[model samples]
Structures are given as C-alpha cells and as structure tokens.
Target: MEKISNFLEQSRMKDYILKTKLGESSLSTVWKAEHRTTGEAVALKQIPVAKLTRHLKNCLECEITFLSSVNHPNIIRLLNFFECEGCIILVMEFCAGGNLASYIRRRGRVQECMAKRFMQQLGAGLKVLKQNHVIHRDLKPENILLSCSECNPILKIADFGLSRILLPDESAETVCGSPLYMAPEILQFQRYDEKVDMWSVGAILFELLNGYPPFHGRTSVQLLQNIKESTSLPFSHLVLPELHPECMDLCSRLLSINPDDRLSFEDFYQHNFLRT
Candidate 1:
C-alpha cells in the first residue's frame, strides 16, 4: 500500500529503528524501538488504521487524548505519537520490570508491606484520574507495570484502551472490564461512576493477599450472581486470619455493593491500613 511505503520513507528520515516485538493485541502491536540519533529506548504501540473500526478508532483516540493530558509518577507516560502508513504509533516510556500480574505469579502472594506500598501508589494515580474526571474502566494487575527490576519497584498504571473521560453529570452505562473485577453496578447494567474503580482496587488487594480473586465462579452467569449477592469479607474462609483487621475493613468498604457507601479517596488515604 502507498501508505505503508510512505511510512517506511518517513521512518528512514526520522531514524527510528524497531528493535523487537514487545507484545500484541487484536487492535495493535507493540515493539521496542530506539531513536537512532538520541539512542532512547521507547515502547511503540502501533495500531493499524486500516483494520480499525470506528469504535476501535475512538478507543485509540481516547487513550492518546487522556494520557497526553495527565502526568503522574504512578501513571505510565506517553512521550510522543504519530500516524503513518495507515497506522498510528504511540511512543511510551519503557518499563523493564514487566506487569504486576506476572510479578504476582512469580511471588505467589505479595507481603502486606509491599502490597500497601503498591496500593498507595495506585491510589495516588487513581486520585489523579478522579480529579481529571477520567475513569479507567479496566484496572487489573496486568495493566499495572513496574518501573524497573528493583527491591521495591515503583508501579505505574498502563493500558488506557478501555478508559473514558466522564462529563460532570454523566455515569457510564456500558459493561466493560474483567468479570472477576467488575463492580455490582457494572454487572447489573446500572449507570456507574468512578466507584467502579474502587471495587477493582479491592479485588486487586484481595488477590495480592490471598493469591487469588475474592470471587470465583464456574460460569459467567454464576459470577455475576455471586458478585450481586456476596457483600461480606470471608476472611476465615479464605484462611487469611493473620491479615490486619483494618485491611479487611478497608477492603469491605471498597467492595461495597452500594456505590454511595464505598470509601472515598480522601477516606482511603487516611485509612488505618495505609497509615500503619
């Protein structure tokens, strides 16, 4: 295609070299690339414009627009972006420590102190998103990455494909996100707000402590029903009696079935679990 040819020509002029494939999704492919002149290592997420539907295009635009507007230590940075060859390339910060999901798999379960540290950073990032009127519909370990391989690596939130900018009076209605992490409102098709993210945080915290999600189901229907009906913390059942009571309390408040009763960011930061 002419577009691809022009992209190649332009890439030669820019002196950007694609070194290795990092990852791929249905809508995009990511590669590790370098700036020939500056010798900077950057992650390049390339989306084939030719293959994108209108919805996918909107998703790409949303990610670029939101990421470019926000800057936080715990949120992944979007350095630069360009379009070429019927594709859009997003240059991003390179995180060498990989995703939190893989980190959890390697370690089984995270210690309380480490989980608290990571949650604090994640909370800070979420606070920024709240202030900016943006909602990250999908918040899971896979979307959280480490800055480097260190004794205590800084966590950075990534993958904004399912995120959305909320209007002052609007509540999102679309059901999205991983089933186990979905809030009750989302599963029941009720209009929901940023509180859905809090629910996800609770799920993440549970998994970090127990090495698995709080809710499990053999089928999708059963999962939704379980989420709807289950509202109490099963500390004894999960064999996590050693966990701090304050921690369990915070988790309960976060995963509240009623959004209004869920812990606010201000309260979350002041909670005894984090304070200790």
Candidate 2:
C-alpha cells in the first residue's frame, strides 16, 4: 500500500491533461487523458505498485508483460508505461465506443449477422493469444472493446488479472470467472485447459441471441447448477425457426457440456455462418 500511495503522489502528466475519472475498481483506477502534444486522447490505468499482496502484484506485472509482447488490430493497444512514486501507470489507446456489455444493454440483442462479425474478430484475437500459449480465463462482453465509429466494432480482449501463461504440460487448477460464463469443467474445479475460453464464447453467443445469459439465479450456487444441467436445453430450441439455424448451430457447438466435444478453431472458422 505504501508503494502505491507513493506512486500516486508522484504521478504527473508528462504530455497529457487528466480530463476525468472513467471508472474504478478495488485494484485500479482509470482516467481519460488528452495528449498535450499529439492532441490525441487515451485511457490511463494506474495500478498501485506497492502494498499489493505479492500474488496480485505479480499478476499486474504479468498483464503488463503480456500486453507489451502481443499486438493485434482487435486487441487493445498499450501506448505507454511509466512509474510514478510507487504506482505503475499504463497509457492505452482509448476506445470511445465502450465495452460490448454496456453496448448490448443499450442496443438490446444484436442482429445475427452483426454478432457473427463480432465472434469472428473475437476468435481472431483468441487465436493469436492461444498461439502464444496464453489462455484468457475471463472472456465476456465487458472485456471486448469497439474500434471506431465506422469500422467493425473490433473485439479487444482486456483485463488480464486472472489470466495466466500456460506451460506446455501445465494445466490450470484454479477456478475463477463470472459464474454465468463459467464452463462446465471450471465449475467442477478440476484441472482444465484452454477449452474453458471456448465455453465463454459460447455463453456470450447465447446471450447475444437471447438478450440475457443462458444461466441465471438469485445466488452463485444456483447459477452453477444451471450451467451444469442446462447444457442440453439450448436457448435456440426456444426461439427455433425465428432465429437463423446457422447461428443456432454455432451456439450449440460452443455451449457443449464436454470440453472435448466443443468446436475447434478450425471448425469455427470453417462454419458457413462466418464465411457469409
């Protein structure tokens, strides 16, 4: 805590003006800044460098390291990094369009064509990460960011606090993610692989069609049970012919209860829905 406090105290705008606070959570704070020289705007995330438990601090460092190494059009770009006092500040490209979760809430369920576009871009981003041996444990609407007003609202995966780089033989044991989006394997608390991410994509696809998550309850336990048992009854079966069969097919394969039975990237890419 002392390190973070000192870092905050030392923070000074190098070439930008602090406009306003965008958001805040327990771990970090976000600010909108306008570059003084370039006249460009960006989002600045300030992470406490000190006083964090060693585990959390290592996590933050991991995110920084990963972001620095990886780059893709659909992924959020890290613009700058600096240390102030005991705080570490990351300046990132700002996406004025906001996250997909808030976007969906305001616009309601998106069109099948539009949702497919999002899924393709999201898959592209995931492909890059998986090729690098990084598995994003949290894959949900909130993490996807829009690119611009005119271009396809590209999905930029962000927030890597729960993410870990998987070793060749290493399998993840820790089960952590939003309950509604958790894969069957994850809820079981068993050692799992990258397939958990596929399950999340499936859940997101289902929500895109139905305007709400497939699983729901007043509490966490109920939500988990819903995921465990609700796999066979798809949201598509309820909507039926009203919804495109192609879209429904994609969702069904994505939401498969068994990770081994889920669609592979090759299969997903080959789907006619995306080709169209």
Model 2 alpha-carbon drift over 4 Å, by segment = 1-12, 149-151, 231-239
> What lDDT would each prediction earn against the true structure?
0.83, 0.78
User: Among all windows of ten consecutive residues in candidate 1, which has the lowest summed lDDT?
Assistant: 231-240
Task: Score every model by TM-score.
Answer: 0.89, 0.88
* Tens-place lDDT digits, model 1, residues 1-276: 977878775775376788999788777888888889999888888888888777667666788988999888899999988777667888899888888888889887887778889889998888888787888888999889899888889999998888888866688887778888888888888999888888999989988887778887886678877877775765445447667788888888988888999987678878889888
Point to the candidate with the largest lDDT.
1
User: In model 2, how many backbone clashes occur?
Assistant: 3
Worst 10 residues of 2 by lDDT: 231-240
Residue-level lDDT for 98 in candidate 2:
82
Query: What CA root-mean-square deviation does each model show from the true structure?
Result: 2.8, 3.4
What's the CA error at residue 17 for candidate 1, in Å?
Answer: 2.9
